[model samples]
Target: MDERLKTNLNLWNAMVPVHVDSKGYRVDKFRSGENHLFPIEREEVGDVRGKSLLHLQCHFGMDTMSWARLGANVTGLDFSEKAIEAACALSAELKIPARFLCSNIYDAPNVLSEKFDVVFTSYGALCWLPDLKKWGAVAAHFVKPGGIFYIAEFHPMTQVMANGGGVAHAGEAKKLELEYSYFSTAMREFPPGPDYSDHSVTLEHGSHEWMYTTAGVVSALLDAGLQIEMLHEHPVCCFQMFPFMVRIEGTRYWRIEGDPIPLTLSIKARKPL
Candidate 1:
């Protein structure tokens, strides 16, 4: 593994225990038979019953086991060994049939040879990858012919906004300030800060991430020979991305006041038979 990825691996390994205990992951609820997946993904990738599903970049297999709960034969692959260990333990304890593998996304082809009926990845997974072309190829490689490849991810537009760092937040009417370029092809380094799942706990290790525009992401899948089925832009996000964002009435999603821009996107693609 590259030095940057190794650094990220260590960071993620540290996050597993924190996330398992965090309210954001709701591990206890999950153990008591709650599905962690949001309605958007469940509705978009409908009826996983009796299908083979492969979840890439699956941190501790919460979503992966959720699919298993829905009757999909599920396999989750992550780079962090700690996460995989936790996932296996959870699967055994809950009696949810699942296979968890530990391997970086780029090297997944060597670790797993079988193809899946659905290749799925979502939320906060894309930024960790430095190369989308290779990521696309790996996704394509895992999907059987005519199978589906789906992703529900944070929009690239959201990454450009200033989260903190001296930016003013004017209640509900806060203006979005651009902190990073959407077109730049550079790796970003973040300093040690609060964990996204639990703001009370701080992460000691900083990590590197890469950004990809919607166009860049779409192009990679097209180049990998997958046919684009649909690309949907959503005005709401699964979490509070900005300080001024408001949560919707009965949902786990948050939205900017007046809904000025897209906060998340989901794409459905199919491999050629």
Candidate 2:
């Protein structure tokens, strides 16, 4: 693996414990049989009952287990061993049968050789990847012919906004400001700091993340031989993506309230029979 990817892996390993305890991830609720899937994903990838599913970059496997709860035979893969361990423990404890593997998305094909009925990944996943084309190929490789591939992700446009820097300034910094570019041709480096699920703890390593245009993501899937089915954009996101986002009461979602920009995007593609 590249030095940058190794750095990201270490950072993720450091975050596993924090996420297990973070309220945002709702580890407690999930343990009580709450489904962690969002409405966008649930609606977009409907009816997982009796299908085999593969989730890429599944952090600790809450979402993967959620699919199992919905009756999909599920396998989740991540690069963080700590996360995979937690996922396994959770699956064993909850009696939700799932297979969790610790492998980088790029190396997934070499480690596993089963094509699934559904290839699924969601929110905050794509940014961690350095290569979308390879990511697309890996996704395609896991989908059986006539099966589906789906992703619900933070829109690339929203990724350009800056999350306010410090806790003291975060509440007051609720304005939409572009700190990065959407079409940047280079990977951006970030300093080590708090994980998003729990901002209280700092990471031991920083990460390198790439930016992609919607066209770039779509083109990669096309190049990977998947036929595009649908692309959907929404005004709200599952997390507080920007400081300006307001939590809509009684829902597990946040929005910029009339910002008129796509905060989230979902795409469904299929492998031809």
Candidate 3:
């Protein structure tokens, strides 16, 4: 792994326990049957019943297991051993017929060689990758001919803004200010933010991240020979990636209320027949 990825992997390892306990991950809810996949995926990747699925960057496998629960023969991969371990444990407990592998997305072909009917990745997956074109090619390499590659991620336009940049709040909440850059570049280190659930048990680690514009993602996949099928821009977001964002309908967040400006986006592509 490169220095940037290595740094973030360490932070993700540290986050495993914290995230498991955090309400945002909702471990207890998952235990009860929450299935963390968003509705957009459920619909976009529809009819997964019995098809093979390869979920990349499958952090702890909640979504992967959910696919298994819905009847897809599923395998999930991630570079974080801690996350893979946790995913394996969850699979065993839930008895979800799924396989979990610990390997970097770039190295996965060497570790596990199998094509799938569906190649899928979801929210928060892309930023972890240092290379967009290579990532897209790797994704294309994993799906059988005529199979699909699907992703629903934060809009790259939204990514160009400062993460913590926001407007003022009235109460004790911290005020929003533009303190970071707005261009595509690798983040060498990020001070860990608050736990998604509890802010009290704070932890900080030097981490890494990257950026990919909308064109970067689409063109890469196209260059890799995945035909563009559907691309939908959503006004709602899955998380409050920015400070001024507000929750809209059905688990979606947005920077502005009563306005739709593509905060989230989803794409479906297929290999040539």
Candidate 4:
């Protein structure tokens, strides 16, 4: 693994236990038969009953097992050994019948040769990848002919704005600022900070991330020969991306007060039959 990816792997490995115990992941609720998946992905991916599905960057397999709950033969892959171990343990405990693999996404082809009926990945997944072209190819490689390739991810547009940008906080509103360039290919490093799932816990490891445009992501899949089906921009996101965002009642999703901008993007593409 590249040094940057290795660094990220360490960070993710540390995050596994934190996230598993965090309320955000809802591991307890999942144990009680609640589906951890958001409506956007469940609706878009549709029925997976009896289909083989591969989930990339699957952290501890909550979402992957959620698919298995819906009757998909699910397999999850992540680079973090701790994460894979947690996922396997959870699957065994629940008797969910899942296969969890520990390997970098780019190296998936070498370790696993089976094609699937669906290739799935979601939220906060793309930013971890340093190269979209190779990532797209890897995703396409596992997708059988006529199989679906689906992603519901954070919109790149949201990445340009500063965190809490343009959102009201403590009776004050701030205009959104472009804190990061939208088109830069440079790798960005982040210092250790509050874990996303558990804000009370500070991560011991820093990590690296990359920025990608919507066009760049779509083009990558197109270049890999997946036919574009539909791309949907959503005003609501699975988590609170901005500090001032409000959570939708009865759902895990959050959104800006007036829903001014797209927070999530979902795409469904298919390999040629």
- What TM-score against the true fold does each predicted structure earn? 0.96, 0.96, 0.89, 0.96
RMSD of each: 2.4, 1.6, 3.0, 2.4
> What local lDDT score does residue 32 receive in model 4, on the 0 to 100 scale?
94
- Model 3 C-alpha RMSD vs. true structure (Å) is 3.0
Model 4, runs deviating above 4 Å: 164-175
**Candidate 3, poorest ten consecutive residues by summed lDDT:** 164-173
Question: Which sections of candidate 2 miss by over 4 Å?
Answer: 164-171
lDDT of 3 by residue, 53-135 (tens): 99999989999999988889999999999999999998998887889999999998899889999999998888888888899
Looking at model 4, the pairs that clash are none
- Candidate 4: tens digits of C-alpha lDDT, residues 136-180: 999999999999999999999888877632222112434345778
For candidate 2, list the clashing residue pairs, or say none: none
Candidate 2 C-alpha lDDT tens digits along 54-99: 9999999999999999999999999999999999999999999999
Give the count of colliding residue pairs in each prediction: 0, 0, 1, 0
lDDT of each: 0.90, 0.88, 0.80, 0.90
lDDT value for candidate 3?
0.80
Which model is ahead, 1 or 3, in terms of lDDT?
Answer: 1
